[model samples]
Target: MVVDRASSTRIVPRDPVTAFGIGNVATTGPTTVRAEQQVSTDLVDHRGRIDLPALAVLFDHLGGLPYFASDPDGSPCVQARLAISMQGGVDVGDRLTANAELLMHDEAFGTTRVDIVTSTGRICSSGTARNVAVGRTFDHNPTGDRGAAAPPGNSDLPGLPLPPAIEPGLDGRVIIEQIAAGTRAAGNLTELLNGRVDTVDHPLGTGVRFTVGTEPWMGNVFGTMHGGIIAAAVAQGCSFAGQANAAAGRDYQVADLAICFLRSPAVQGADVVVEVTPVKIGRRVASFDAAMHAHDGTLLSRCSADVHYR
Candidate 1:
């Protein structure tokens, strides 16, 4: 499902972020987009379920399409806020489809909703994104050739090397320890984006800081860190931090996550630091606050998430 940009007057450049994160997508109308992919080993977490960061990438990709499609000038829009809630579960080998619709829009901003459903009609996840026009316009014909090269295929994108496999049924804390000790990988999505759990401290109960290296594959069409990747880093930080603070013999899951993009981080091989701080740690539920910063200390994004104990 290559993007059907033929009818449009603009040529959106192909970037590695879209190539790797969004695989294949199609636009049904000016206000809707659809994408499909199969759950593979690289898309699953240690528990063999789809990872939240992977869902964030898909949400960001499809959720921005409606805004792009409705704008006649093809002006670029950056996501101002993104929120997602996981309702169901999906695992490896499941086929998934995402449908996105434009919920509302005005001159300066637009809101879009996307729902990811499995083959059995289960709603795996649902999310909404708010995007604001950046006040910049693209060339009517940037390539000067309407018949420009097509988007890159899978072969053209960089492959995510599988991390060292971990033993099955390991609890979250054990996995975190293994990751910290360099004994196990930090799952597929983290490895794909060069994310690392750098430090785990017990200050104020528990605090976790992770770093994601700025690689070319993590850049958006504008050459900055993709909003989805930023959200992914935040999700990773919060999840690990929550695990570090969870009670023994108990497990937790992210119930909801919201992210606000304050600024974009340049993809210059520097590390984006994500610091996770606990807001409240309850027996039934927990809340966390995460902040992402550039290597030079410039704040990039802020996120909040809720985790439910099980």
Candidate 2:
């Protein structure tokens, strides 16, 4: 089943909590907002723990809302970039609460800080974002009702690539494809998001390859994982690899994660391979790179993460 993401990029001033699966659970202060999401079975890994990639994107949507409220109908607030760090894992049906604070919002950039905690008040994840005001506003309606106006198609914009367009219309509505004129097709990075795990012996040390399936959930409108999730997949695998190498070693929180999406993966019928290579294992900070690939040896995407090991 395809997820409807028609208005995900509008950057309008409204309640995004309803758009994403998370709910606006509380408001402690003028600048503070809290959201909670009930993790379902589809959102979890094989171990039934919340998938890091899925959780990371959730942080982006949930954390950005309070800051977006600061701008509302003013500047077009867009999440230019974000980074997430995981401290622990959450399971299915677990309620994840995110408390966000608007750090700053100006004509140029917007930033926010978010902390995600479990029911017992365990800090599981933290995030910082750098968003920008694009100087353009879409149909900003607080009621989320455009009121009978034909929404702008992704292709109508000058150079903005539309979200992966699920083609041919599922039910009499045709969604335009988002690839550029000369853009390349790798596989749906999001489709490869439903992750799988298999252990492999390595000459350097022990290696674990993480794989993922496509579709249903964990995909953008284009039907693939988001760039954030691509990076998180690497971090997730390396976190596993790091833990394996660290056995009785120090636990680390991801301090830095970087990714380059070489090609868009297919939306269906493909598996992504996540192979982690430890660049440096130090007493202070350890680093690793996870490559997302196809079974045919195609390099779909890649990411590198730095962790505070101690």
Candidate 3:
């Protein structure tokens, strides 16, 4: 399916996660996709900047477009691995656009690269998404109407509800203990996911256990938790773990994150648990591993992250 970049032809979102997270989307070419969103306060981090995990959600959406474009049968695909690197900062109210290009693909796997930039032409983030075919064909069209484009602004999109309201006074800083105790809110992306830090006993020191209730809005077209949301959850777990291990008076940032999806958890309003463990804590850098599990302890995904201290 060839999409003319100059025409009004756009890819309509079939899932709530994509509609709510990335806003409007379009297939600019046979191998390229574009998405746009005006950053809102609910998308910012404690630093009042666009959250990395939120960007991961966006990456996950745009990254999957090329595979759909290239497949003639519309084979079912799932995210295999995702890696994102932080480049610059983005604040609330900033209009951001993401462009994704297909790198390579085979019968079993496909890889796509995405770059996010602000209206001011500032690069905000970039990443690559790897997806694997599931050996099945879609029963129905999963991409929705490719010829009809939604009206300008996300509010005009039919059934696209407003994002959850962030509690006032939530500055992007997450206090591990406070959030775990339910005394403070993670706000922003975590708030949107209804993520809560939970207390759990583990052999790994300086770790965190996060739980999020899966809602329909968090699901993919298949009615399961979206891969990008899973990635965001893993990122949050790693961020909390790194913060807990950092020395006093030191500041840290998530340098990069990579996650692999092993299983899909149905979004039945059940709680999904994410456990993070410190792999190594160096003077200038720290590494951590995270695992996402169903409430019954079924491992769903795994992630590794690196944090740079300054």
- So what's the TM-score on candidate 2? 0.55
Better of 1 and 2 by lDDT: 1
Task: Tell me, by TM-score, which candidate is best.
Answer: 1
CA lDDT scores, all candidates in order: 0.71, 0.53, 0.70
Angstrom error of the Cα, residue 70, model 3: value is: 0.5
lDDT by residue (231-310, candidate 1, tens digit) is 87788788787777777667667778999999989887999999988888888888989999999999999999988778
Q: Which candidate leads the pack in lDDT?
A: 1
Comparing 2 with 3 on TM-score, the higher-scoring candidate is 3
lDDT of 2 by residue, 163-186 (tens): 333222221101101111113221
Candidate 3 is scored at a TM of: 0.81
> Arrange candidates by TM-score, highest first: which order?
1, 3, 2
Query: What C-alpha lDDT, on a 0 to 100 scale, does residue 194 get in candidate 2?
Result: 47
Model 1 poorest 10 in a row by lDDT:
141-150
Task: List, in order, the clash count of every candidate structure.
Answer: 0, 12, 4
Off by over 4 Å in 1: 1-21, 137-174
